[model samples]
Target chain A: MKPLLSVRGLSKRFGTRVACRDVDFDLWPGEVLGIVGESGSGKTTLLNCLAGRLTPETGSVTYNSAAYGTVDVHDLSEARRRLLSRTEWGFVNQDAREGLRMGVSAGANIGERLMAVGARHYGDIRRTASDWLDRVEIERGRLDDRPTTYSGGMRQRLQIARNLVSEPRLVFMDEPTGGLDVSVQARILDLLRSLVGSLHLSAVLVTHDLGVARLLTHRLMVMQGGAVVEDGLTDQVLDDPQHAYTQMLVASILPV
Target chain B: MMDTISSSSSGPKEHDGPVLKVAGLTKSFIVHAHGDLALPVLRNVALAVSPGECLALVGPSGAGKSTLLRSLYGNYRADAGSIRVHHDHAWAELVGAEPRTVLDVRRRTMGFVSQFLRVIPRVATVDVVAEPLLRLGADPAEARDRAEFLLALLNIPQHLWQLPPATFSGGEQQRVNIARSLIVDYPILLLDEPTASLDAGNRDRVVELIGQRRDAGSALVGIFHDVGVRELLANRVFEVSP
Candidate 1:
């Protein structure tokens, strides 16, 4: 089967510092691939490179888009890449505040993506937005409230709802549950698990939490010093880490 | 703990090779506050379960019974060994398999029913049970209908079907959890204390459900606390100890 996204020898550098190097893998459809590493290990940089946010210095990032067909992400024109971002792709930032418009009501936040994709009926947009809020477990009563007033978990869930409303096939998330309470994190994890399964979404999730990686990802890449040190199934990598860095990372997880 | 295995059609299930095989698995739990005191639990535990068999894990408390269950499910990081699961008509290593491979195995072949019910808050009880099918891309209506059927079979009141099971009694919650696990008809099933919270009647129903699964050629490995349930369901029992 053709992969939804393929990468080969992708490298990125910031001045003299290597941000990422020689990253290569294929993200299959409906698969969740997790990138795990300490801060500054280049996990985020690799994600940005894959998302076309940071242009790599070398190598190709190919996407087999259902909408645009097979095309190298970096080769796409600025307009087309932007179209791709607003259409078939979704990026969830580490901070919900950065990913969402705090001033707008939750309904509008979800509706904007639909509108960007040519959805214009006012009643239908409102209904769909409300439905999305429900899907994300946000109450319909909160649909009119600005995200700025919501709790951390609610805002994060809303951000997810906004990204998913337009039905993007692939999603890139950075620390989607990074700063939440443990309980809230479990709730969000559950929501994400169901969403991924039911929607058959293909995703690239970047998290330092091995627990999160174990729960949400299918394959895992352990990043160290901007290079992939080891990659394999999430359970295998966590349960039997072969690389010293991967072994250390797995050991670092506190027992619960 | 109790487990049962109804081996395959050959001389024995072992003749066909167990569908789930574990060998040389070892693990230790370290207590960090106590100066990293390592508590070694499972010590080179080995077992195999063939299709149409139910293998039970029976042992005293602290005998690492639960640990063995979790290790078999790829929940624990074993110090050494292999958990070879024969799925999709091939042997896939679980001890060090990739997350993608493990998830794929879980989706299509294996089902693990832990003791508790962990569901998204506020989702209907029937919907919670229907979710596995939904994730497999089944029609939402058909999935819900099958969930309703299971709930009815398990004696979940029709009036409470739309309400979340989070507020249900412990016994009710366990039944919901079992129904969810049984919904998938996985080729290999791992169950832990599935009937710990149920009454005799409901426990009997769970026994029948598991029996039906074994009859349908699904290999089951379970830890049942109830002796009656174990006797009714497990044809082969494997013992464990510290």
Candidate 2:
């Protein structure tokens, strides 16, 4: 099958600092690919480039959009890119505040995505928002409250609801379980796992945590410095890492 | 107290038939705005959960799945029924148990994970997760250490542990709520949509954690909408009708 997303010769740089170099990959429909690396290893840069958040200095990201067919994400017009971002794609930030509108009511934050997709009826939007809240495990009673009043976990859940409310086919998640408590991360991981399966979402998950990759991802790409050092099936790579860097990464995980 | 009927000396062994038993459990709500209209949420519900068993409640919305779970946890009082929980070597009736008995049961025998996390403003995330152990008279350091472990397992960053959960995200708060409940190994566990907000990775961890608890002999009553998790943990399913 033709991949849902294709990245070729992807590279990015900031002045003299090279962020990503010669990264190449293909993500199939309904496949979850994890980009794992240490800090400043270009995983985030590569993700940003693919998600169209950062314009790569070289290479191309071609997405097979349901609405627009196959198109280059970086070459699209600004208006069309915005539309794609709001409709076919979702980006979940590590920090909830970075992704969520703190001043808006939780209901509005979720409804806004639906509205962007041309859903205009107030009752329908409100009902959808309420349903999303329930899915994210937020109390429907807190629908009218601003996210600023929410706890960190609540805000993250709200963020997930807001992003997934429109049912985007492809999502970009950066350390989705990054900063929460252990038990909290477990619950969120469980929810994410279910959502991914039910939604059939193809995702690019960027994380430093190997455990996160092992549980959520089907394929893995280990990055060191600014390039892909190893890439293969998640279990195979984690179980028997071929690259020295991948070996080090796997060995570094503290045994539970 | 009826609880004294089966003191440790005379009570059934730990591997006895069922740790929890419910018979003819029924509940209804009166809506004054509708001229005292009676809304029957649950009726004639009967269930028995043995040690190491997980009984999942599955049904359509408003089918009273959550109501049944809450009733088991004594959050909602049943109008007519008996909720017999095997604790302190005896079966205590939860339906009309004294307030003190209910509180005592909650503290020592039951652990509930509600759908929404009730955040206590200004309480550090670590302390919030640790409070359950602390209440059980565990060493303060040990309690905090356990709290930290669960928090880390759930992916809560170490830096955020000292900060209050008030500023945390919804998922973050729910994690804390889960951590708090799981910290104490109560004999009976009641969970309401426990993995509803979690992501794919964390969800698997929760399934394993719940599996461990069930394997360790905790009788679990849960409303599991996630079929994957329900299948993984539930030994029997009780379907609630709308």
Candidate 3:
């Protein structure tokens, strides 16, 4: 199948520091690609490039969609990019707080996306927001509460709801499970597994945890110093460490 | 699960002396811009967070999480259902409470970390952190001392402690938000998504601090949507039903 997203020769720099250099990748529909690396390895930098949060100095991001047809994501009109971000692209941050407006009610947070896409009926927006809240397992009663009043775990869950409420075709999750506890992490992993299967959406997950990649990814990419060192099937690369860096990473994960 | 921790920090749960409580809470608004009609935002809902228990509320966008949080804080008055709180040796609803009573609840009992970190625009970090303490009538020297200690605990460099938090990074601003919420020693602490803009390292530090607050005897309720964050703090998770 033709890929949903394709990136070629992408590069980004901050002053003299190179964040991403000549990065290349492709994402197919319903595929989960895990990007793993140490701090400053450019995993997040690459995500920024993909999401258009950072404009790369060079390269192209092509999006081939059934509804919108093929277009270079990097070269789209500003209006088109806004539409894509508001309606088609979902970005989940490592910190849920970054993704949510803590000042608003949960209902408003979820409904805001629908409203952005021209959902004007109050009843419809509330019902839709309520439905998503239930999907994420929050109480309907708490929908009016400001996000600031919620706990850390609750905020994270709220962030997921905020992103997923829009029903994007592709989602980018940066270190989705980095700060969670074991049981909560397991539950979230299970939730992601089910959500992707049911929604039939593609995901680009960035993390340092091999366990997270092992649970949710179809493919894996190892990054170091702003470049990809290896890319392969998750099992293949995880089971038979070909590169020395990959071997160290595989060895570093605590045995479950 | 309850008895393994320290004793000096232990206190009664929020239910025993709930600063905020609601039963059959419901709210709605007239959408003048959206085809004339009253749209219900929250259906009949009821919940209470006990003191010292970090109750997590998770849901998709538009799930009314913020509405519910605001209702408890007396920001949005519910259309129906009674919100009652035990305040000043009496139980009363914060909605329409006397001004002094509302002020007292805000100052002496509950600390809210708003989504926007509303810090003084041009004040030093120590003063910003110490503001809550100063508001509660602490001596300036004592407040500054407490603020300095908290800044260190948050790993903010001593040099930055005397400077304006406005000049800090996103992560640094978030730490100040945490310190500001914690300085007052309020019995109940309400935090909206506290670590949204943080990088991985700073994110972990914030999570650890939330855990520390739970250990410090303050009843906490927060809205979070990150799976990792929910995993770390939610002793009980409530998912809004479809």
DockQ of 1: 0.24
Writing each residue's lDDT as its tens digit, candidate 2 over A59-162 gives: 99999999999999999998999999999899999999999988889989999999989999999999999988899888999999999999888888888999
Candidate order, TM-score descending? 1, 2, 3
Report, to 2 decimal places, the DockQ of model 3: 0.01
Query: How high is each candidate's TM-score?
Result: 0.74, 0.53, 0.51
Which is superior by lDDT, 1 or 3? 1
Off by over 4 Å in 1: A8-24, A36-41, A57-60, A67-69, A100-158, A177-194, A208-256, B1-48, B58-68, B76-86, B89-96, B152-172, B197-201, B225-229, B239-242
Best by TM-score: 1
Question: Which candidate should be chosen as best, given DockQ against the real structure?
Answer: 1
Q: Model 1, range A111-228, lDDT digits (tens) per residue?
A: 9999989999999999999998989889999989999899999999999999988889899999999999988887898888878876779999999998888878888899999899
* Global fold similarity of model 3 (TM-score): 0.51
Whichever of 1 and 2 has more DockQ, that candidate is 1
**Chain A accuracy of model 3 expressed as TM-score:** 0.95
Q: Which model, 1 or 2, shows the larger TM-score?
A: 1
Model 2 ranges with Cα > 4 A deviation: B1-242
Worst 10 residues of 2 chain A by lDDT: A233-242
Clash total of candidate 3:
63
Model 1: what TM-score?
A: 0.74
